[model samples]
Target: MNAQPLLEVRDLHLSVRAPNGNRAPVLRGVDLSLARGQVLGLVGESGGGKTMVGKAILGVLPDGARVERGSILFDGKDVLAMPGSARRMLSGKSMSMILQNPMTALNPVMRIEDQITDVLRLHMRMDKAAARERALEMLDAVQIRDPRRVLRQYPHELSGGMCQRVVIAIAFACNPALIVADEPTTALDVTVQHQVLRLIRDLQMKSQTCVLFVTHDLGVVAKVCDAVSVIFAGRIIESGPVREVFEAPRHRYTRALLEAAPRYDRPETALHPISPALREELTQEIVHTYRIPGHAV
Candidate 1:
């Protein structure tokens, strides 16, 4: 492992404007680090601010969202402090994202070739013919059959799995240093999800690209991630190596999550859902720690 991490997020505090025009804290002092060639899984329940961490790193936070404090350092440079042009230049070429839904991530009307080639042309500075050829190669790299034909087709013409493959291809097209994959397999079926996970792991290994995999699935994290961070109520309560955390989780919430997740090996075991008391306790802890007025965890 590299001594210096490829990406580092330190004490990130974020707030989003609520309907009443008040800023509600979304991410409360999030700290994360991903070394080179590592896959770090951000695991948490929905709305726990997992996706916001990725968005903050990508500089693509939605309207009304603001990062109030802390810095995101990528390759020793603070991305949060970078100029707009520098950040924009670094985003597509040095870093990229594989979004949750491929259908929505891709343009509906654009042909596959154009979508893939556009990134290459813009970031890699490839000419038309070179970009087109590279696009075909990328499609093939993602194991898409009949790359030439698929390139001519629109996103709607492809299966969900195929569309995801295309998105993965685009994400890896520039050989980016880091990729923030936010629930990339949530929209796919079990078999396809397995395939996609394997594909991502394989590509990450081949290119040695660091990845921040954001997902709610512990099973997925076990299979794909080297390290895992458990987020709750806008805070990372527990984080460590996958085997260590899974076998001996330190936090109550981490243990509760593990118990709640279905285990194929223990089919007869009863599922234990997280209790409301625990949720309330964690929320109270957050409130006490931050002392943010009117903040809803």
Candidate 2:
């Protein structure tokens, strides 16, 4: 058994070259480590490179983006240095991702049965009937009541929440040692988000799987993550135990992100936008017209 960290991302510097050949560094030497059975939360605003970090570990960079430096080690081996064949072998059964958009992740043309069976066949070497049973069981495990019908249906037939759950079911069905969930509840209604999150937590505890949860919602991070990292401008400016960060934020960015989230102490108007000049300088964005300057909205 390997006692090494399940996933260790060294000073990872990632960048993208635009069509005009301008280079943009999205992740500036971001470092994170996850041992087996731990959960690490990456929180930040949109375009802050939270998702990019997760994708980098999965070897799925966006168009034009490349990992300029650093190594992602999983179970004591460098993921990038491994052969493509070895990485492919390690993905589904060892590591998997629950993408932010289930509609895009699941195939519209394929039945859910076939979609899951593909994993079983290619990764687990299971026969058709066994894979089919496992796929249905997986649906049930994720709390999809109509497991059989769902297995026979295409992704388009399911609601967005259902589709997201299906994505979770498929990704988590085989108990991969590590799971990278990018906004695991983005598509669900507010009511179902908790259920989905609870499902992830329950499964994580059961499987002792390390999870790197990426989301812009600090509320979600508060509910799930054991440890949290607050990212800004592609840098982890603050990080610590969830309780400590929530109670006593060390970084100004972290404090601002929390103060921006609705709070009982703050008056409702605290969310009003600050002067365009102030925001532009802080976030490099001109569109945040309603956020109060000292805190968040």
The global C-alpha lDDT for each of the candidates, from Candidate 1 onward, is: 0.92, 0.81
Top TM-score prediction, candidate number: 1
After TM-score superposition, what is the CA distance of residue 127 in candidate 2 from its true location, in Å? 1.0
Residues 70-182, candidate 1: write the lDDT tens digits: 89999989999999999989986899999989999999999999999999999999999999999998888899999999999999999999999999999999999999999
lDDT of 1: 0.92
Residues 90-134 of candidate 2 have per-residue lDDT tens digits of: 875788999878999999999999998898887788999999999
Each candidate: RMSD = 1.6, 6.2
* Every model's TM-score: 0.96, 0.88
TM-score of decoy 1: 0.96
What is the clash count for each candidate, in the order shown? 0, 4
Report RMSD for candidate 1: 1.6
Where does the lowest 10-residue lDDT sum fall in candidate 2?
286-295
